[model samples]
Target: MTRFAVVAMMAVALVGCGGDGGDQSQEAAPEADAAPAPGTVTIVEPADGAELDAGPVIFVMETEGVEIVSAGNMDPGTGHHHLIVDADVDWTLPIPNDPGVHYHMGLAQTEFTVEDLTPGEHRIIAVVADGVHIPLDPPVADTITVVVR
Candidate 1:
């Protein structure tokens, strides 16, 4: 498997580990006996308004049953994460999973690898979407700002 695929698989494993048991499909039914709780999203790294250096790929998140439904453009009520660099980008657009400008973790994992950022001020925001890859109505997370030196 390719390096990216390996990383992706590992991410999926981690996410699945936290799952409460259901089919592999992101569209899987919430659980028969338990009603699906209102999911939440949060950035675990580079906290809100953090400063970072350019080099290692940083991990961002949208927690709460987060899944990546598309490598580009997050589907509504679905899955995924987008890394915005140098500017404010919309989380609702169908941005491709280009490793250069954007890292798309489609329904595979919540973990992100943010490597090779240019020296300057940049912002990273993570959003959690539902099964269709759309951002949650209220948006699962807040935009995190970071400075890369």
Candidate 2:
């Protein structure tokens, strides 16, 4: 196996997830530049500023240059993705895995579903973080809001 493969395997064992089942990383390097282009994150579904009735909030995400991996590995050009429901993020710290609120895609999954949110206006922010869960330098993030009825 390659060095990164080994490291990734180890990270999976060492930092699987917090008790809430969201992979949480609090000890990663500050940033990622291993990818070709400066990364960008966008919501491909539910168009920003959209309105909907009560149901599942399915999000399709778009990412480039940055490879999605476990939050436990600090591979450059590689990082994981997460959805910040109802608010913006503190780029100064590791993104929290607060379950439905701050959802972390530990395995680097590109899509998500938030179900049964109470009626209100909700802001969803997509953030890409390095192996240790720290936001990229200058932070690659995009925000969209949906009003639920």
Candidate 3:
């Protein structure tokens, strides 16, 4: 009789679950079809901990598993670059996106030249972003601090 009561309760619960029950089970997709990881960006020129001459500033960078579209969405395996100048100057810290505090490279990843930096302590940070010019939730890569003299 206890078993019968238990079965009756289950039937009533199911009936109360009206419509989809909100507990749909799903199968996992194959790992081979999983989304690829975002690219890794590293400044190849003006090696980290280097100083710059008094002139235009250029940034050389490389991004893997991402495209370097100059103006558009960062298609699959593609991403773009953004530059932040004198930004509180720290990578261990999140990149600043303040209107005038940051410089965006948009979709370009090639060399960047900034000719108006005054002679003083300045920061040159390069960040990688997905297409549509949006930085990754946590940012893929950030090269911070390149003092200009």
Candidate 4:
């Protein structure tokens, strides 16, 4: 008797859930075919801890499993570079745009040039951020220090 009652209730439930008259095929959100892979970035030029002339420095970088794209939706393996110059990086949010410190290298930039630097030691941090410039949750980044003369 209990089994019969359960079956009857399920039948009524199915009837209530009959196909909706609304559009059911609009389109699904974009989903990456492969699971998100780990990503890494590094500053390749201006060897860390090297001293150089105070004017015009070129920063070269590389990445693995990461595409430097303008900030927007999370495309699994994509983001942009944020070059943090002479200061500490606040990993809590999008890399800032202050000309003196934060450098937002949207449009998938691999290298950036700093035209001038005061003669002194400075720190450089390169961060990879998702579309919209927000650093990934784990925050893929690299840091190096250099001195200018």
12-128 per-residue lDDT for model 2 (tens digits) = 877655223222233332467543447677787889988988998888777655667777888777787888887668888988877878988888787888876779998888998
Estimate, for each residue in 66-123, the C-alpha lDDT of model 4 and write its tens digit.
6667666578767888888878766777677888788887766678898767889999
- Deviation of model 2 at 48, angstroms: 0.7
In model 4, which residue pairs have backbone atoms overlapping below 3 Å? 71-131, 71-132, 72-131, 72-132
Q: Which ten residues in a row have the lowest lDDT in candidate 2?
A: 18-27
Give Cα distance to truth, residue 14, candidate 3, Å: 65
Off by over 4 Å in 3: 1-37, 88-100, 107-109
Off by over 4 Å in 1: 1-38, 65-78, 130-133
For model 3, how does the per-residue alpha-carbon lDDT over 93-146 read when each residue is reduced to its tens digit? 434556446666764645676777677676666776665556655456656566
**Candidate number that wins on TM-score, 2 or 3:** 2
> What TM-score would each prediction reach against the true structure?
0.55, 0.71, 0.59, 0.71
Better of 1 and 4 by TM-score: 4
Clash total of candidate 3: 7
Measure candidate 1: CA RMSD: 10.4
C-alpha lDDT of candidate 4 relative to the true structure: 0.77
Per-residue lDDT of 35-147 in model 1, one digit per residue for the tens?
Answer: 65545566777776667766885665644554445545444445556555544445575544466665556645657777677777666666565444455655665566677
